[model samples]
Target: MDEKNHIITSPVMGTFYRSSAPGKAALVEEGQAITPSDIVCMIESMKIFTELRCEHPGIVKRFLVENEDPVMKNQALIEIEIH
Candidate 1:
């Protein structure tokens, strides 16, 4: 909740994927500048993949969840530092 940090949370319970598809690049990396509209990750549930976007502009500080990791609703995915 700190002003310098912004957390990206999972909206649903599912498997988290860092890339858009298998063997693709992870959407954003640590220290990468990002905008509110950037796609940060994906959550797939019941064969449905949901694109997760940033709500605040910042640089990605770290990823809290790993690729293919099961995430719960509202689980923190990544942390970013607001620019």
Candidate 2:
């Protein structure tokens, strides 16, 4: 089987968060296995936080945006190697 690269994009324009809160373990990390229902990250807009879920099953290759970085809608946030 061949593995394909999949880009996970931000669904909304907001600040990206790797963890639920500061000083907390990251929700997901590089090289972590992820499922379609997995919460990959969080985005905060106007003080409202939204959980960003994975749409594909794969291994997290890397994060395109750093934590607390502002991202635009449809901006690539993570690179995943599809299972």
Candidate 3:
């Protein structure tokens, strides 16, 4: 099974921030290798920060959402090519 189809998705409804905090570098960028425990981004909801992690290790292929974009529950955030 390929990992490309396994895409990283959002957890809950909130605003998706590329970085952990505002004005900081993004959590991961294109071509970056991310592990299951690695944080890809953070979703802020009700004033709570939620870390979004990958389900497997892979190289980032695309960012489905732009910085400071609103994301819905279970939305596709990024696509990773499973290695």
Best by TM-score: 1
TM-scores of all models?
A: 0.94, 0.89, 0.89
> Candidate 2 on 1-83: residue-level lDDT in tens?
13598887887899999999999999999999999988889999889999987777989999999999999999999888988
Candidate 1 — which residues are off by over 4 angstroms? none
Q: lDDT (CA) for every model shown?
A: 0.91, 0.90, 0.84
Query: Which of 2 and 3 is the better model by lDDT?
Result: 2
lDDT of 2 at 37: 89
User: Model 1, residue 23: displacement in angstroms?
Assistant: 0.8
Every candidate's CA RMSD: 0.9, 2.4, 1.8
Stretches of candidate 2 exceeding 4 Å from the true structure: 1-3
Maximum-lDDT candidate: 1
What digit string (tens of lDDT, one per residue) describes model 3 on residues 1-83? 26355577778899999898778988899998878988988999889989988777888888889998999999998888887
lDDT of candidate 1 over 1-83, digit per residue (tens): 78888888988999999999999998888889999889989999999999998888889999998899999999999998988
Model 3 vs. true fold: TM:
0.89
Candidate 3 off by > 4 Å:
1-3
